[model samples]
Target: MTDCGCDKAKAELVEYLHNELARDDASDIREHMAGCADCSSEFHVNVVMTETVQRACRETAPEELRVQVLARLRDLQASHG
Candidate 1:
């Protein structure tokens, strides 16, 4: 496989992280990161950020807020309908 340089690696990093890249493309990025510290650092930061955001999104809203929002949505729908 060809060695994809820093630009391609950085550009495809998100896709690589999300498992959206094809096998060969992913391999190219992995190979690039193995040798390139900057790209590897950026990938590490992205992984942390992605995990933090995912954890934050997993939190549920307060029950009171959930009920209120649902009620408001129903009211708006009833009015519109």
Candidate 2:
């Protein structure tokens, strides 16, 4: 496997992190990261950021906030419709 240089690897890091790249492209990024410390470090940061965003998305709003938002939406619907 050829080392896809840092430019391509960095450019595709997000797609690689989210499994959005085609198989061969992903493999190329992985191979590049294996040998390039800079790309690897950037990939690690992206991984942590992706995990953090995923975790944040999983969190539910407070019950009071949910109710308030729903109430506001209902009021707007009633006013508009």
Candidate 3:
């Protein structure tokens, strides 16, 4: 819904939740977020969603699944080529 100020001049707040700006840029974004309620809420939700997904992956993704997927991918590639 909201563009977070990238190419489209805005993007989802997830873009900023990483806190990945340079020092001056981070400061400017923080200042803007402090005044923007919508952006602030989006940032919080993005953080929570990220953490939730990370935890879910940690609990559910087994090493065996990775191996199986890789093997299938190799087989598929071999057949296609």
- Pull out the clashing pairs in model 2: none
Model 3 spans with C-alpha error above 4 angstroms: 1-12, 61-81
lDDT of 3 by residue, 1-81 (tens): 232343221363454567665556565566666767766776677779999988988886579999999999999999999
Quote the lDDT for 47 in model 2: 92
Clashes of each: 0, 0, 6
Alpha-carbon runs more than 4 Å astray in model 1: 63-81
lDDT of 1 by residue, 1-81 (tens): 788999999999999999999999999999999999999999999999999999999999999999999999999999999
lDDT of 2 by residue, 1-81 (tens): 788899999999999988999999999999999999999999999999989999999999999999999999999999999
Note each model's CA RMSD in angstroms. 2.6, 2.4, 6.2
lDDT of each: 0.98, 0.94, 0.65
Tell me how many residue pairs clash in candidate 2: 0
Q: What RMSD does model 2 have? A: 2.4
TM-score for each candidate, following the candidate numbering: 0.75, 0.75, 0.55
Cα lDDT over the full model 3: 0.65
Off by over 4 Å in 2: 67-81
In model 2, the Cα lDDT at residue 49 comes to: 93
Q: What is the lDDT of residue 28 in candidate 2?
A: 91
